[model samples]
Target: MKQSLILTILVTLTSFQRASAIPFQVRADLDSCLNSAGLTSIYPSSSGYASAAQAYNLRFQYSPAALVYPTSENAVAAAVKCAGSLNVPVSARSGGHSYAAYGLGGQDGALVVDLSKLKAITINSDQTATIQTGNRLGDVALTLYNNGGRAMPHGTSPEVGVGGHLGCGGFGLDSRMWGLFLDQALSARVVLSNGTIVAASPSENSDLFWAIRGAAPSFGIVTEYKFKTYPAPSSNIIFSYSYWSTPQATASSIFSAFQTFAQTSAPPTLGIQAILASAGAPGQLYVSLTGVFYGTKSDFNNAINPLLTKIPKPQGTSVVTYGWLDSLVQLGGQSLNTSTTPDGTDTFFAKSLMVPQEAPMTSAAIQSFFNYLGNQGTSSDTVSLTTLYSMHCEP
Candidate 1:
């Protein structure tokens, strides 16, 4: 074990809502449609509506017209049909973890198709998994580990729904080795806007398959996803190096070093990111370089040494290794193993940028970024910058 990060920042909770509410008659009509189709519907006047309509970000909280909990594909299709008939817009909520709360329609008065009740995973003999998209990354990880020594590239956040995560190009520690979660998707069962369920694959509904893999919510709702799986790695390790109260110059150097080393020297087995966070003192920020290596502890130090040699010495460091299930838990938290609750809510404002391997950040731009942060980065407490390269290496 080694030293870890030191700078700490506390967040203040804030709630935001528009002056919008659904009409009683419309909510009642949507509920009636869902109830007639054997689905559970919660209206604004109904109990548990507030909790059911809550967004993970808490900032984009909006009152939906109706919440539909569909237990089957037919129920999901029925809800779609009912929405079409009533001339209502519909949004599907998988984990309700959208930063912009698009799952809640990104606005009010949309019929929300809640899919928490539809999580079911099937591991086939050919190392393929047919899982309901309603399952979160945590649910998928635990099930794959328990049923078979299997794994797939997914998000580090366990609370993110597979439906939304994969669609938005899911990234994880396994991503460096296995590509994205969408890359493993073999097929999907999608309910179209007109209430028809169809199978999307390369050989069938080829256009629909392509659209669903990336921009799924734009087209329709996916009920289940058939994914290609891999044998879980026997040796999984996580490492982190923290620098406390780093000056803007050193922070800029570290960023430049990481970008250069990762594009050239970092192997596919390593997935890494950096964070420049508030240190509470003026002109002070802490930076941490952390990620998971899909190889053994014996080779981890060697793989990381080049990057460390390029950057300033870290004040604290830590390295740990675990098995398949434990590694997932370590990457996230205990929620990766047994997460039933909604986890935690936050009021956040975040922006992300992906730097491709073809074009690394220029030295001048890197310095400018740090300079701006030191001078005027107080709007947010922490800024996590993740740079992913497509090494295209085999596992």
Candidate 2:
């Protein structure tokens, strides 16, 4: 009797598995998705899917089971619910500016929810900017700049998405004077994991609001962000200083000096970085300190000359002050392209670290890292380096 009962239970489980293995359920849901008039504005067919699959970081491509555009938070919620009901994975894409694999890295047979249609900026009378998740930094900056020269301290690249940057603690030229991008954040509208839309602000949903300010991406997909804005200066100056190192020892000294200058004497108006390389024909053991200053030439020179004196006499120095937009373009190393997000390309691998001081081990680690680059057969010209310097504001 025990053996017979066990056999019946096994048969029942096997029958259930076979019944659920078919795609009929998925197909029915997909048919409904196709007929989703509510999603007609956002859902793209296979032909449309090809273009949407392109990502800013050109490292890879994503092909989703379906592509839907969410015009509003409600639309976004609807799409999320649909995906959940169908038991499909959902990947949210705002400006498609993810540097790593997170943006379009959808699992197999997942729904790629694209939020490009939600690009809108509403500026209230009180100097607050409410931007949709899909808005790019360039557009927002230009708009604010035109509206009485207002600006926010943000990344040097204009094509970056406000959503991605704010989500990850954004920083750029004005970071030292101001702070990380998250510092200016006022609030956000986010969709929870369970398909509910909620407003997160300091006064309402305060815990979620705090989480939204720094780590919204990890917790939920934010649809809109509100930021505090300020009046921007008319023009700015960018000074680039470069030096050649005949030996690795000189390179190490230059790095150490820059570290001391950054920690002890650096000014908030100045943005600085130290670049190192080989000497000779191909050029190795070279170091450079680059800067972007927000003040006048005289004021900037006063702050920079002492710093310059610490390193070897520069082989080349260039100073150009222009309209803020022109200055931003030069900083990004790219001409302005309106159709696509700025600095959105899948061409390189980038990693950043925050170090308080430079030590022998720091130099050794960098040398080792560059050595590994050689092993990977990477040329020096193709590699780019960025070093950040931070200083505390006066009490």
Candidate 3:
């Protein structure tokens, strides 16, 4: 990979020397808007870019015609209008957590509306929470826990923006019982491409409401989201089980059994995740089955006990029950303070594949894929894989 990258760079330097077109009058217009809107600076070249992470890649950078921070929706509207008038590409960036660069991918000479200044969270008497575009996941969770344990199922990390999470169908441990984050969405205030501001809800702007629920980036800039909150459950029981197996086939059988058990009798309160990894054993797989049970210990035990025969093992298992909020802090990795980096953020790049069904060929295919991954030059410790059965809207 290193050699390939070096060769590509050498070829690029030798072959490419084209300059971009710039309109002097458009630059003057943009400068006028920036001055009036109190923007810090506008960078038209690579020097003005900074490294930022979406949920995935660590080294992603966005080169914007102007990285303008607006203090108000009106100011944002003004900037958007200016960009539209000048035929400039515009991308809205809240917390910069879009893994595929959906929020920061500039075509050329694009205007980036950075909404980090819009952070705000307010809880209403009806147990509904209003979150701004810039608010992060953990921030909202902590605030909700403090305000009386009124909480909603949110993404695992705290640095992810509320806008992106809800926009992309966010889910967490409690999702097996509740639903995706968009399921709780009540309303949103959006700034359209044409600079028209509108409020969307179940009753008003219903088409836009449906679109923004799951396909937000294709729509417009969502300034704020109102979500219906549930009374935070009192206690949560987390069960961890790790298995030691000899060969890939044995581990794969366990996974297949898990799929069967999860399908027939898994309770709504039980959410399970299996991590197939090679922590200590080379070419061997360790199956870590973790569960978040949203019920009393007795009820949880009763619900999961019937399926233990499917996972016959001499491996290790641990269970802990705590207040829901405290369990969240622990399970979501906030207790280690490793949830974010030194600058309060980390990058995660992940891809997902949906398996419609499993056959002999499918199992063999997966085994080959894992074998290839084990051969990669990078340390195996740096890579992780998790699979789960998502309970969508059934409960």
Candidate 4:
């Protein structure tokens, strides 16, 4: 089960928000409504509004009409009912880390429903876990591991909210074996535009069940999710390889070699991605291949050694084993605890896509792409890491 977007009937209102600023009176009216409903809220005039309205990416910042914290499902319904009546747009804020900032309504003056207080993880008698949308990936990881040695497939970012990550396509290093994080969902509780509480699953509201999993932003607000959990693997292999100060030709060959190996021989337990980054100066290419292999150290070596023979020796490389949770902490470069959520922000542009395996790029095409990448003079400020989803063969 997954609770997702609070985007619903008022979605149309978000488009008009940009045409002009919301009336000051409307803000006051919303402030009054929240007060009357007894919901914990912050208004623009409130000192906490600035922090409450903060989005994860510094590239985008939207002024929400009002930020409300609903502690229970009934309270979530009341908040929606209030917004639907006042014609105010609504956006649910879980981790507040949408790449496009859609979590800020993709516009201005929408009512931001902050779900931070709803972080709860319940291990059920069945082989499943019920998680509130407010819990971040790190929170979810630590809670499940500490309680029941349970695990689920999810992205590497710890601050990303479960609502947004799983609502979208939740992919992780282990996705090749377990599929997406969303695939673990059995059902979810949602608050509809009518302010009605409903359960969406395969057998109930089947249409909505499908819609929310892939595109929950336009559907309704999900409060909690019940997911099938897997026993945490005992052994995990985390690996990294970096090529620095490399020429375009070498970078292209490195990426090409990785693609060939990924498509032909990578195991499902092996999840890897190649990163192409712009170094300090123009014509400088920095490439890295990093991911996790969920198996014994000997087995990982047997699988990765063959791929190593195909490419030039990397300037830096690492192949170490760690416990399941430790592997996540190392790969994420942060603590996986909910005690204190991170508040880091960056301004950059990044996009992701998958290249078809049937029509792999010719060596000429690969060279051409790298040629342009090496010539780009953009600095770290404007351009950040660009990752290629090269693990397509790990079906």
Candidate 5:
């Protein structure tokens, strides 16, 4: 059986009501309209309201006027139209996995358009897929593998919603070879702010289509996505080696060696990433090199051996091969199912920058960065720096 899970929250006005906002009676009217339009799951401040308002990041929490679940696109349109009529702000929630909790409005008093119930996966005759925005990367990966040994390049986190991930450019283990998730999108069905449904693609609504490719949440609620998929590779190999910085072998030396390997030895089929972090030991820093190669174990080892020889002595090393579905599970670092709830939710602040492939970091700059990292305390709350090197065409 197919499964669709939608979680929408309408925060109660409670102590946060404002005199300039819509009246209580108008809010009730909007609720009545949605319920009449076949939105069966409506939660006020009571009932599953707390859980409905929770986001993947526990840091930001806010309540909406009401939580709703729309089973179909028409039901979504109805909720939007009703909210517009009542002058109530609406926010769309798909998987509720936004790090900043944007699905919860980052504030309060907004109707959340939960799209979880829209989950559906249809494999077409062509090498393409019609996927509902509510599906998570994990569910999508597993489903594609099961149906036709197909796969889409997406983020490692299985809990990330297709709506947000594809909307804002997705990067994954195989991204170096296949490309980002947004590059796979062929077309989309979106609900405009005025409660109108429209199709966006290169041939139709070209401007909206281009805008939604990267900045989706700003435009409207996306109901469905049509994506190009690739045939699953027969096998994938994951390799990792961890090194502890010491008097003889320093983090600077390791980073310099990594930059050389990445620039000289890395291939398109191999995705390389490095992390400089303290492994629960104060004043002790460690550098870890991890790679994913989309090929057999022998080829992976052959490609990775020379680079390993260039780096410092390792505290630990591991290499394992996995099938397509198993590779996604390992990449996610968690077991994922078709549940609407996200797994790996925590308070974190993240930032990333893109560097030109041709320009490699200088050894002095690498040493400086490692010195700064070394100064940071090795507390549980300490922040770590992770660098990913993926080679592909500019999107």
Candidate 6:
């Protein structure tokens, strides 16, 4: 009786799998539909398909039934309509930086709407700019800077796409002062799931505007974003301090002091990050604090001196002043004149948690973290725990 029951279960599972699979004929039908919609950049599971599915994270590798590159909003609408008509799942790919590689659909046999071809940036007369969703942060920064010394707060990674980044509430060096990337956004143009194009703002499609601000991927395909830009600061003061320590208590002490400083003393124009890593001698650890201040050197020194006194002694320290664009290069770990493509891709898994502002970092918690790191076999693979000072800013 047991053997018969197991056989029945296996047969049922196999049947369900087969039912869900996308057959060759179905894929061909979808491809034909996409091609018929006037999309010339369509790629099926042959010739250029592999490169079309590449993502910033190597771990997310999925081959969609069809990948369509739509150059204009009309083209995007056509692709969406055709995908819906054919009953094929669809995903939008901008900078292809989805952590789980969701830009290509977490599973197989979906249609990917590749938006990399739409790269237009128009600066309005009123200090506002209309940016296409396909523009990467690096390209956006350089373009804005070169055009009029304008800037916007965004993620540190230069390769992050404006669509998914702003859609998910982007934060970066200037975030503490200017707020998130979404906060600067005045409006957006989105293609809804029903294949209709709509403008969303505070006064138009207000509900959709609100929903798309933070929950964008679920709502629609963002075609473009209009943002209010600010005059770029003339220069930035970058500083770094590092300490070597094997004891968990030392790490805890440094973290506790840094947290207190970040909460109480740090100004909005100052951005600081703390990194604890097992990159020292075998079985040892180190702590590093790095930051950038978007103000005069004198003002930066005055504001950071008190915090420096509270932290433990650093084994080394460095400080430098740089122009606005150059400072971004330093922060992004890219050469001054390098292209905007992402530096590299890697295979990794990540987990995250949000700690409340009022909560304290106790020594016990720090020791537990250290213990966990110590047990993760020594294969020269590095592990890092990073903390950034983030506070709510008025929009």
Residues 245-325, model 4: lDDT tens digits: 788788888888887886677787888777676565677788888888999988998888878999899999988899999
lDDT of 6 by residue, 241-278 (tens): 88766455566677777767766777888877776666
Give a tens-digit lDDT track for model 3, residues 1-395: 00000000000011112233447777778877667767655456435455332213343444456667776777677777777777777777775666545566433456777777787789998889888887777778878878978888866766667777787677677776787788899999998888788999999999999998887877888889999888888878988878754455666666666666555677767877766655455556666777788989899988778667776673889999988667877776664232344334334444454443232224565566545433441244433344343321100
Question: What lDDT tens digits, residue by residue, belong to model 5 across residues 1-395?
Answer: 11111111112121222222346897778778887887865555457877777767665667677767788888888888888888888888877777667776666678888888899899999969999988888889888888889998887888888888877777776776887798899999999988999999999999999998888888888899899998999888887888765432276787677667666666668876776665445446777788689998788888887787876678888888888778777878776575744455565544444444465666666665555555543533444434344321111
For TM-score, candidate 2 versus 5, the one ahead is 5
**Per-model TM-score on C-alpha atoms:** 0.92, 0.82, 0.82, 0.90, 0.87, 0.89
Clashes of 1: 0
> In model 2, where do residues sit more than 4 Å from their true spots?
1-31, 41-45, 244-246, 277-283, 334-337, 340-344, 357-384, 389-395
Those runs of model 5 whose alpha carbons end farther than 4 Å from true positions after fitting are 1-26, 244-249, 280-283, 340-344, 358-361, 383-385, 389-395
Best by lDDT: 1
Locate the minimum summed-lDDT window of 10 residues in model 2: 1-10
Position 69, candidate 6: lDDT: 85
Worst lDDT 10-window in candidate 5: 1-10
Q: Give the alpha carbon lDDT tens digit for every residue of 254-311 in model 1.
A: 8778877776778888888776765656566778888888888768888998998998
Model 4: colliding residue pairs: 1-186, 1-187, 1-225, 1-226, 3-222, 4-222, 5-220, 5-221
Which of the numbered candidates is closest to the native, going by highest TM-score?
1
Residue ranges of candidate 4 with Cα displaced over 4 Å: 1-20, 377-395
Taken over the whole model, the C-alpha lDDT of each candidate is: 0.79, 0.64, 0.65, 0.77, 0.73, 0.74
User: What is the number of backbone collisions in each predicted candidate, taken in the order shown?
Assistant: 0, 13, 2, 8, 11, 0
Displacement of residue 76 (Cα, Å) in model 6 is: 0.6
Deviation from native of the Cα of residue 339 in model 1, angstroms: 4.9
lDDT-based ranking, best first?
1, 4, 6, 5, 3, 2
Q: Rate residue 388 of model 1 by lDDT.
A: 54
